[model samples]
Target: MKLPSPLYTTQYGKAYVGDSLELLDCLSDNSVNLVITSPPFALQRQKEYGNKSQEDYVDWLAVFAKKIKRVIKNDGSFVLDLGGAYEKGRPTRSLYNYKILIKFCEDLGFFLAEEFFWFNPSKLPSPIEWVNKRKIRAKDAVNTIWWFSKSEYPKADIKKVLTPYSERMKQLLKNSEKFYTPKKRPSGHDISKEFGNGNGNGGAIPPNLLQISNSESNSKYLRFCKIANIQGHPARFPRQLPEFFIKFLTDPGDVVLDIFAGSNTTGEAAEGHGRKWLAFEKEKDYLAASSFRFLENNKSDSEIQGFYGALLSEKEVEIRSKQSALIFK
Candidate 1:
């Protein structure tokens, strides 16, 4: 499908600047292999990038859910990462995130493929009234990641996202006979002798609890934003988050999308993984700063300024790869 003129282009993707709903409407049905995004949370306090209040968040997000369902492939997946919120002025937690899951599955005809929690080890203590000052609650460090699929069996491969085996598991693999024998436990599941022989699997299957730190203090994107005197997107997810889903859910040539492409991190991940991607963000400054992700690191300060200057001045700037970076026509 022909999309609008992109704010910037990379070898693997294009980043668009506009309302996501309007941009998504331009796509054809079953065109996307995966849609992974982290929308603005329904925070108690409003942020500069903009966010809906808790009461209106579910209905607001449902509108996009319908559009996403129409565009995604039959076996495709929609992965949503939502940060938890507390009730206004109270210490009570809000149920907006869970509500979105139930609404999408029960009302929007999506299946709950699985649920995952992203544990941000570097997350700060939040809602100072309750957590930091009053000391009534623990730090809110985990974001609920809902994996929704149009079909019961979505395209996924656990092997693609396996973690390295622990040291003990390596020892067991090397000396299976010395360690123990396979047997049934109180759990009532029978352990086969095949467990003794190394299955030749590269790593162990990872758990649903994903441990990633949100540390991007000195990335190229941030450096560019600093040079341009632009404020960076505040809630940028680590690139690993998108890389995980892209590997597990889609092949190299499949299309991946991020509806709320703050700083276009998903696009960068998709590019690195050889997937065609589309990023939609409403803020032009954020999209402009994201172009730095695709540029070669050796670019000088003057050259970088010239590139960014064109992005700001021109109606649309085609950001060709370093091999063809100067080709505007």
Candidate 2:
């Protein structure tokens, strides 16, 4: 079968605005170094992007996973961020989306490496059916990130990604340095040691449980959605979240793929971090917003002016310049 074409190379990187499955099929096998994405949640509310039945949702998402498996390098990793769903007006934590995805990946021959929780302490509270109907309280939060690999051994540098120790931790390490010092080595043997005080090293290497706020007011994402005249996708992740993974998992110039690129947070984060990025969004409105945001965030003033000169009439440019100045002020 024929595949899609890669498009639009920028200083930040290249991004394809189209269907994810078709785009993945286009990529060369083992071409991608990392895959990070947050797909649409199977929620009851009306999603700005396409929404389907829960069964269809899982099946549709599986097709993208299959393609991801094809393109990811043998030692590469995949990170999927999913949220749990409720069923029959009850708080069913058992119906986790990650479970189905994990099973699907395992069946498709991907190794299940690790699972992390993006714990949002700022999550909205979900009302309980029993209490609301005159009984108890229901749970609120709903997001999980799953990490998978193409092989048993993946390319991750844990030491390079360690979070630095805090001031108190540094002091403790200083106090305990003598204890960590090695005793006399055997004759002619080269002995070296790596040690720390172990008193809370900058939040313990960023635990699988991540606690981040999800407030969206005045965010660049909201601004881009407004400018593009698109209804914002409800499940957009914070840029910092994906940025951490990009920094920790991949090196500069490595290819990063987000098959279910939702609002393209992974692409934005990858660009900011000097990594090559590929994102796929099926919805046209989302594609437009993602493209505009990616370009706008990465453009310099001179570049923006050049674009204005080429695309806008003199009167329109003057109006736009005034608006831009007003925004900066």
Candidate with maximal TM-score: 1
lDDT digits (tens) for residues 98-197 of candidate 2: 6565666667888877778887777766544643554465555647777888998988865545667776556556665544454546774432222333
> Would you give me the overall lDDT of model 2?
0.66
- How many backbone clashes does every candidate have? 0, 3
**Candidate that scores best on lDDT:** 1
Per-model TM against the reference = 0.95, 0.76
Candidate 1, superposed: residue stretches over 4 Å from native: 187-196, 322-324
When superposed on Cα atoms, how far off is each prediction in RMSD?
1.6, 7.1
Quantify all predictions' global Cα lDDT against the true fold. 0.89, 0.66
Give the clashing residue pairs of candidate 1, or none. Answer: none
C-alpha RMSD (angstroms) for model 1: 1.6
